[model samples]
Target: MSKRKPQPPPKTFSVRPKRSLRHTLPFGLLLILILAAFSFTSYESYASLYDADYVGVEVCADCHTIMYDRWKDSPHANMTHQPSPETVVGDFNDSSWMLPPEGQLLPYDDELPAMRTFTEGADFYMALRRPGTADFTSFKIAYVIGYQYRQTYLTLEEGGSLAPPPPAMVYRTARVLPLLEPPREQHPHSRRFVGANDHPQFGVEPVLCPVPHHQLRHSGP
Candidate 1:
């Protein structure tokens, strides 16, 4: 009986199989996370290229009111303003001065001496001349006014119906003008002359600080 019971127990055997997850949830979630990370990285790389508009100071004011208000009162912001009896600072009615005509020497010769003079006009006007053409045949001062160096000169395009100066004459004299002496550095109160590089400290350099800030230097070969 013992031998038969042992043989019967030995014949009955049970086997348990390994359990495995058949769902693709974990793998799918990992793939989604990887795709999301790649998309975020790509977006950051191309952000600058998408911003192409020239958002001036006015646009910045919309978001940063306080900062814009401070900048508005700054000297840099008030560079451009209407020339009124109060806002106008230069001597508009001062004596007229002679400016060398095109292709003429600075010192002025007896024959072809100073052929042009800058005089005060009845109203503000900008003097515009085409490049290479000394004959300022066509002139119009309607809507443009700008500042060159420290002097205030109106644009010829803003005169509307107001008559323009002669081909050689760029402006009119509100009154008789006197000749100005050549600017000297020691004076410290010299009137500005266009294209004059006399004073290394003053002129356009100190006035226009931002221009030289990022001026590109050319490398010689």
Candidate 2:
């Protein structure tokens, strides 16, 4: 045989690394962190329902039907409403009322009293002249207070202030609020000297006027 070049010895490959935790440690830690994050997120999501204690007024209707029926129509039910055609009972079709709508209209700088101006188109507004200001500022009526006897308006103002009342003549330094008034009447009578116990109009009800709560619950009254 021709002197063949000596073949290089067969090269040997290194054995595969052992299947140990060291190689997969990073992946295991990542998986554990992901699981922990999911658990914490789930816990936080489910723990948020403890905010309000009452279920709602609807739930109370089940056991207190009479109370619900009476309450549903009472003035208390109409205590607050949004100012709209459905709730507002005032005349707002370019109608004007004197500033002291209860009294005579006074002469303002523009010959129109600083007291009154409002219009109703798509919305209602109170165009009133602030005491010191020369011009009138238009305030948008945001809410209606009641609908039983009469309705009053709440206006939104700058800086989220609650209007107290329409400035009759002067605006108070305190926070403003909605202008509302209950219908009131007073009849003056001659004063007569009388004993304390002789108070006729000041009738007193016994300490327990209405029946006890438990009795009311059992009986329909």
Candidate 3:
């Protein structure tokens, strides 16, 4: 019997640990998802501060009909808008006045040539005299802010040579602000203007106007 050449010692076999594709794939996907979410949130936060960039209320009305209907006529809805016959509440017809320069608040004075404000055709205009000289310049009203307790009209800061009229041409500078309360009764000797009056328009003045408190609640993230 030819002794079968000692069958080479049963060939030794070795097994090595293998990495799981399932475990690695899911972890990589989770990392990618987290990165995408972070990028989107950061961009949204940066775009909200610009007022001119604000998507007008009309854009928001599509999905929120009921709320939009309620807000359409609400004071907050009219907070700021272009000047128009329908939107203007002031009695421009019978109430044109030569208002004192923006800073000279209160009782219409007789000392200087007051600034004249009234409606002309379709637009409102203010005839303002240049300080020291007699150059009367007329400015058109551009925007109106607030309508409930007070309605303040604003002129553009630098739309033209008449812009930034005098003191400063800041966005909120008031061209005219109608008083909510009727004129106060005048007393002899103590000549104080009755009712509400236009305050000074400042370039960097800090003025706080009233807004509906509930409107803030409606704003969502």
| Best model number under lDDT | 3
Q: lDDT by residue for model 2 over 2-96, one digit each (tens)?
A: 89899999999999878788879999999999999988877643334533342555566899999877877776565555666776666555544
TM-score of 1: 0.28
lDDT of 3 by residue, 1-221 (tens): 66756656677789876869986999999999999999887774443565436565677678999887887776555565567887666555533345446545544344455455568788976566654454667767776555554464455543221111221111222334322222323211122211111222211122344221111111123
Q: Which is the better candidate, 1 or 3, if ranked by TM-score?
A: 3
After superposition of all CA atoms, the RMSD between model 3 and the true structure is 13.6
After TM-score superposition, the amount by which residue 134's alpha carbon in candidate 2 deviates from its true location, in angstroms, is 5.8
TM-score of 3: 0.42
Candidate 1 on 100-203: residue-level lDDT in tens? 35434433332331223223454443232322344332322221122322322323223222221322111222221222223312221122222212222221
Off by over 4 Å in 3: 1-9, 14-56, 59-63, 93-95, 98-113, 119-122, 130-134, 159-221
Candidate 1: list runs displaced more than 4 Å.
1-56, 59-66, 80-97, 100-221
Clashing pairs in 2: 99-115, 162-176, 163-176, 163-177, 164-176, 164-177
For TM-score, the strongest prediction is: 2
Each model's TM-score? 0.28, 0.44, 0.42
How do all the candidates rank in terms of lDDT, highest first? 3, 2, 1
